[model samples]
Structures are given as C-alpha cells and as structure tokens.
Target: MFAASIKSKTQSLRLQSSRLMPLSQQYRAQSNLSNNKSYWSHIPSWKGVSNDEFVSYRWQLRNTVSDKLKLYKFLDEVLPERLGSTENEQLKRIRTRTNFIEDAIAAIKLAPMAIRLTPHVLSLIDWNNPLDDPIRRQFLPLRSSIIPDHKYLELDSLHEEQDSPVPGLVHRYPGRALFLATSICPVYCRFCTRSYAVGGNTDTVSKKPQKPSRKRWEVVFEHIANDKSLQDIVVSGGDSYFLQPDHVREIGERLLDIPHIKRVRFASKGLAVAPGRILDDSDPWTDNLIAVSNKGREMGKQVCLHTHINHANEITWITRLAANKLFKHGVIVRNQSVLLKGVNNTFTALSDLIKSLSDINIQPYYVYQCDMVQGIEDLRTPLHEIIDLDKQIRGTLSGFMMPSFVIDLPGGGGKRLVSTYEKYEHGIATYKAPGLPGAKGEMTYTYHDPKPVKTAVLEEFQQRQLEALERGETLEQFFAQSAAHLPRSPLPNPSSNQNPLRPQTTSTDIVPEFWAPTPKPAYAYSQGM
Candidate 1:
C-alpha cells in the first residue's frame, strides 16, 4: 500500500513538471534578453556602442544622468510621441510625450529625492509605456499619480535622527547599528526612506548630505569599538558602491577588527542597478569585497553584501553573471526588496522575483513594507495588501528561501512581522515593539494606509495641480488653498515617538475598512494574487 501511494505521488509530480516545463523555458528566454542583445543601444546616443564599452564600470559612471538638463534630454530621446496606454486610471493623463515630460519636471520640483540614473537602469525602462513600467515607477516621479501624503507620512519616518547616537551612526536596536557612511547612490530612488540625507538637495528639500571622509568615520568607528554589547554593523551610505575600493576594504576591515562585532553587512544596490562593476576586471570593488568576506570567515565572523533588487526585470544576464561570480568566490550576497504599489506588491510578481533571486544563489532576505516617507504616497499600498501577499507566497517557496515580510515600525520600534499588529481597523494598523530597549518597547507604533480618492476626482485634481505648477505655484502654495474641507487622518499613538508630517490635503475619501477577507490561493503562474 505504501509503495502504491508513493508511485501515484511520483507520477503526479512528473505530470506537473511536464505541464510547467514549456512555460518555465519561455520565462527564462524572455528574462535573458541581454544574452545576445546590446540592450543599451536602444537609446539614441548609445546606438553604436559595443558590449565591452557598455560593460565597463567607468563607462556607466561617465554616462550616468544626474542633473535636470541631462534627465530632460534623456526623456526627450527615449519617450515616444504617444506612449502606450495603461490600466492605471491615476496615470491615464500621462499619455503624450508633452504630458509626460511636463508632469515629470513638475513632479521633480516637488520631490524630496533628486534625479540620478545609471545607463544600465535607464536601458531597462520600457519607454513605449513609461508611466506604467515598474522600473520607471520606482526611479522616476510622476506628478499625475502623486497624491496627498497620509497625515502620518514624514521626512524622517523611522526617526533615525532621534536614534542617531553618533552623527551618521544610528543605534536603535540593542546590539545592531546602521553606519551611514555616505549620502549618495548611483541612482536615487524616488521612494528613498533616507531622503532626509541621501542625494542632492531638491526644490522641496534641503538635505544634510553625509559626504565620505575618514575624519568623520573615525568617530563612528570609535563609538562601535567602545560599545561592548554591539555585535552587528550595517555599513551603508549614499551606497558602499560609491565608495572607492580602498574605502570598502578599510571600512570592512575596521569593523571586523572590533572584538564584539560578529557580523558586518555592506549594503548597496550596485549589483542590481549597475551590475557591470562586478564583472569589470579593471575595477577592484568586487576584489575588495571578496577579500573582506574571506578575512571575516577566517576570523569566524560573517561579512556579506546586502543588495536591493525589487523586481525580476532588474535582473539581467549581467546581474546573473555578477551574482554567480560572487557565489563562486564565496562572497555571501542577500537581497532586500521593497513592496511598491505597482511593482512587486502582487503574489505572482513577488514570488517570481524570489524564485529568480534564489536561482542565482542570492538569498531573498526581507520583503519590506514601503516606509512612511515624504513624496512617495503614490508608491505605498495599504497595509492589508502586504499581509495578504505574504500569506499567498509563504508556502510557495522552500523554507529557507522564504523571506520575512515586515514593516520597520514607524518610530524607532524596529522591524516586526506584518501579522504581529496589536490592532488593525479603520485604515489604521498599530503595533508594539517589545524587542526595543527602554519604554519604547511598551509603546505603540502606527501605520496608516494612503487615503483614497475616487479615480475621476483624483485625475481632475492632478490636472488642476499640474496647471498650478506650470503657472509658478510652489507645491506648498497649491496645497495651502485646498486642504480645509478634507477628512482628518488618525493621529499617531501617543506613546509612539513619530511626529506627524502631514501635508495639507488637496482631497481624500476615507478608507473605512481595514480588514479584508482571506483571499483565494493563487496559481503558481498567475500574474496576480
């Protein structure tokens, strides 16, 4: 009887694989477009560029877009006269080249993050349908889709500034610390949680940029050495990728030398956005990283690279080769992805991304809820969406491959599982961080979903706001005249430490129901949950 049962199950497994084999092959083929194609040549300026030139890390840096004029020129060259239409009602107004450019420039003026894009990332955007493309949505701000910030959205949402013991070192958790080594990235994300300090100053924000300097770093290093309880250190900045090869080695070695430090993670999104650097033999960035990993292993401490790659589309042949190089070299690499509204918020997108990552041997570490930061209300999904998506994706992957879906609680309460909420109702979800030290452990933190606006009303509001922006009205002036009648949002928990960072509302409808019904399970290959 046992043999018969086993035989039947084995036959069933064969049947399932046979059916999925073709689709899986198709998926791999579509994903490896860079296998033969020079993907960046699609852009006008790089039409005649060779693969060697394109793969040079220096070439990517020299061609990176930083200022408004370069960005505008790129947009003019890439966006078609008439863009492909979209299912997104909020982004419908951005169909024409003129509509898209004007709306984007205006959005840039209001954004907290400045524009910065590498040629590799630029090449990945589907210009034919820029507005709805996930890569474009993550890096570029669109005024048409911009909405009023939830009353709780803040510039420094996690209260990093409050917990920062040293100027750039954030000591929040008992044994862990975030060493912000710089304030620049190869590409500035529109939804950056560290907008308070990263990137150049935008029109709406004056930044406290943390430039790389050994003088400044010594204080941070000394503090870490003295703190006997510290065991983990996350060295992040504009990005460790922006650091010189020497900086990477120095920082990694310095931290590893500390007696209490058991782990050192150098965080950067370079492997995803500018992957060629890992393959550039002339560059020593990858060499330094590998050296540190080997040294840490010999010392019985762990040193690894924590990269951010949110979408599977961000992974190319270069990304795969880069990941493989690290894996073969004994460099441990892990990924942390953000759950953006139009990006990887669905179970299918999220699960596919996880599978794609694990296939390259990069552990899918954490799927973070979007932070409560300024200028990115458009990218945030309601809290329940993350909770539901987590349920749908958990059992689909191997136990070790599954990621922790969490929200880094809005004050300094730290990361907790999405389902660990103390109370969730009326578009508001509250949690307590008992893991945090002091009274903060007993205090409650809160997260409010972006307020709703009916589609027609929101589209109208965008049109009016865009008109005001063109006529020289600042983002502040436009909101000042329109907020009086909108509904009030829930205040933060009194015991929590977040100060409300609400912008005056242009308009909003209440999100009355916070609890959603348990969703039906998704098919393995479905496009959405």
Candidate 2:
C-alpha cells in the first residue's frame, strides 16, 4: 500500500512538471490563431462600427486614404504631431501658394510612381510617430527620392526586361516563369524593384508595354503550354491580388490545363497592405480565390499565395485573420521580405518578423538584399551586414522560419546566395551568381554607407554649377563638359519633357484593362486626388 501511494505521488509530480512547461513545448505546437488579439481596437475611426462592416474588404478599399488632403486630415485627427512645426510651415507655404515645398512635393508625385495608401495599411501606422513607422517609411513619399543620386544603379536592376522572352512574362529561372498579370498595386512600395514598370511610369528606359493585352496573354499562355520543362509559374505584377477574382480564377484554370505545370503561386503584397481583398466574406474575390485553391487541390497541384511583408509591424491581427481564412481554404501561404536598411535590417527586427510569420502558419521564404534599383540608394544595406544578421538569426529560429539571404545579381545574372561572397574590400563585395551567362567569374558590387547625406556637399555641388553659369556658360554646355570627365551617366535634359532613357515607340493599340471590367471615372482610382 505504501509503494502504491509513492507511485501515485510520482505521477502527480510528473503532471505538475508538464503543466509548468511553456504551452508551446508542452505538445505539438499549433498556429497562434488560437490566441485572440484585437489589432484594430485602438482605431478611433473604427469605433462603434459593426464587426461585419469593419471586416468588409470593400469597405476598406472604398475608404482608402488616396489623396494628400485625406491623408493629412487623418494624420491631423490621430497624430497632430506628424504635421508638426515643419509640416505646418509647409502647409502655410502651400496655402500662400508658395512654390518652394509645394513644387518639391509636386515633382515627387509626378516622377514615375505615385503615392498610394490603403486605409487598412494606414490603420497599422502609429500615427503618433509616423516618420519612424516602418509601414509609413515603405509607402510614403520623400523629397530625397527625387534627387539624382546613386547613378551606378540601373533602372532595370534585375535586368528583368532582358530575360523576358515576351512583354509580360519573365523567364529568369529554368523551370519557373513569372507572369506579369497586372501592373497595378493596392499600395505602391517606395523601393519597388519594378517601379519603372508599375505605377504608370512613362519615363522608363525599357519601352515595354506596362500591361499585357488579351493577345499578349494568349501568346504567354502558349509559351508556357509549349514548354514542358516549365513546371512552376509565379503570377505577379504590381500585385496579382489587384486582378479581379474571375481573372485570377481564369489564370489558374489555364495553368492547371497545362499537364506539366505542377505549381501555381500568386505573388502579392495585398495580404500585408490590403488584407481585406482576401478576408472579406462578402467580396466575391475571396470566393473565387477559394474556388481556384480547391481546383488546384483536386488536381493534386500546389496553389500557394506568396506575400511580400518586410517588417514585423506589418503582421497585424487583421493580416492574421486574412491568412487564417486562406489557411482554412487549404491555401499554403508564404512570405518574402526585402532586407532594406533602416527597415528589417537588424537581427531583432528580422527575428520578430520571421517569428510573427511562423506563428501565423506562413513560412518565411527569402530575405532578399535590396536590389540595385535607382532612387533607392538610401534603402540598400551593405552585403556584410546582411550576412552577419543572417548568421545571428539562423540558429535562434526554426528551420522553416529562417529566411535565406540572397542577392539578385545585376544585368539578369539571377539571384545568388550572399553567404558565398568571393571577396570583400572597401565598400565593394564580389558574388558569383549561379546561372549567369559567359565566364563563371565573381562580379563586384558596391554598396554605400548608411550615413545621411550632408547638406553642405549638395550645396557645394550646386554652387559650382551656379559659378559656371555666372561665367556665361550655358547649363547644357556645362553639363556636357562635365560628362566628359565624370564616370557617371549623363543627366536628363531639363529643356525636354521626354525621358531620354525611354525608348521611342509609335504603337497606338489600346491594351486590355486588367483591374475592373468596366472603365471607371479617373477620380475613382486616382492615386492622390
């Protein structure tokens, strides 16, 4: 009887120990969806709104903060401090019709890509401190972006245009083909690799048409269908989620019809920028997504949704809800993030982001080094920093949660593992891309330091130009004379409105619209009213 009592005590002790352990280690870990968190509870605008209304994707889209005035009004209400003394001065300048700051802001808007912010994304911002807000940094415009620095960077950083056998499809890899379905995004990221193509940039060097027509799509489909070697197809654009539900469904159906096509993945930022596009039960797009996913499942093919989420802060409760809904519908979700300086560059930031994604059942895929895209020199971090950060975070997280640090080699050379750096020197690192053409030699890349640009340096440069002009030299003559000695690309002519980089084209055929069925009024979809 004493032995029996001891055995009972031992069992009780074991049970207690098990209970003391963290819930994650206690059993097979499930998704963090079981934990309830209300991300939108703090929003004043959402107050007194029904859950149905709040969750409605259409409501989110319809109420998107598109205009500068709307954005200013929202920020004023929430965080009056954002438009502090400096912004107030700028506003005063605008009210007085002064052209200083007003012209600067106007130039930024007119330069290629325009500003676009969804209400759902805006709600994620900490209005009190927007400048430091990761979400705002990714979407909001800056005057520095208009400045012509980082002349070394190419307009087509990845050389995507060269790799494209067709206008809309990019076949960079052997078996995979990327289909540019639409050239529109819910929110335009400031550091977009394809900024030249998307957002209606008429000033791009590559004169390739923005969106594909019905005939162009047919040709693309034929190319994929004919190539049996191609098994995986990535449907992306400004964002594939921007496409209508029927269009997405049709694309999937067409891909499935190709017997060799084993996987169809949709690359979109909507899951992060605009989750309502997928989560709203009332929206027919969600139903169409489910139907396409189900069809892929029945055919024994992989249908996945790959999202671009850079920062940990981007993963909100609403994002999780949208992901969870997709999960329930048997769609596999994954995340790919760009490793931008001051963004997700730190070990702590990346760790939190990867952990957050894993918790939501979305696998962290790739942490790509910021591409050598023009106008994004401020965002790019050095290769050494990225490598060190990757090492620091690798062992701390699960294998699936850890992302591969990769760099897409310039001139269509393709993505290379950043770990295999052939050489490192003074601000220059050489990497040997896997399947690049010609000699298998390491390619040298230069990355600038993260220090802020000195105002004096810019002033000095401008002062020299003014001095030359005062000496009776024409601005064009001055620039032309400077170009002979300088190792930089020639600056665009200020006298001509036409972009010198843009190829002259005479084609006048109307391309088929990919967003909505019927043509809507310009005000309905204009970036900033």
Give the best candidate by TM-score.
1
Q: Across residues 307-375, which tens digit of lDDT does each residue of candidate 2 receive?
A: 999988887777777787777667899898998866788888888899999888889998888876544
Clashing pairs in 1: 182-238, 184-238
Candidate 1's C-alpha runs over 4 A off are 1-35, 455-529
Per-model CA lDDT versus the true structure: 0.81, 0.64
- Backbone-clash count (model 2): 0
Residues 392-500, candidate 1: write the lDDT tens digits: 9888889999999999988778999999999887667899998889899999998877776677665666676667667877444555445443354445566867543
Candidate 2 achieves a global lDDT of 0.64
Residue 134 in candidate 2, Cα distance off native in Å = 1.2
Per candidate, the number of residue pairs that clash is 2, 0
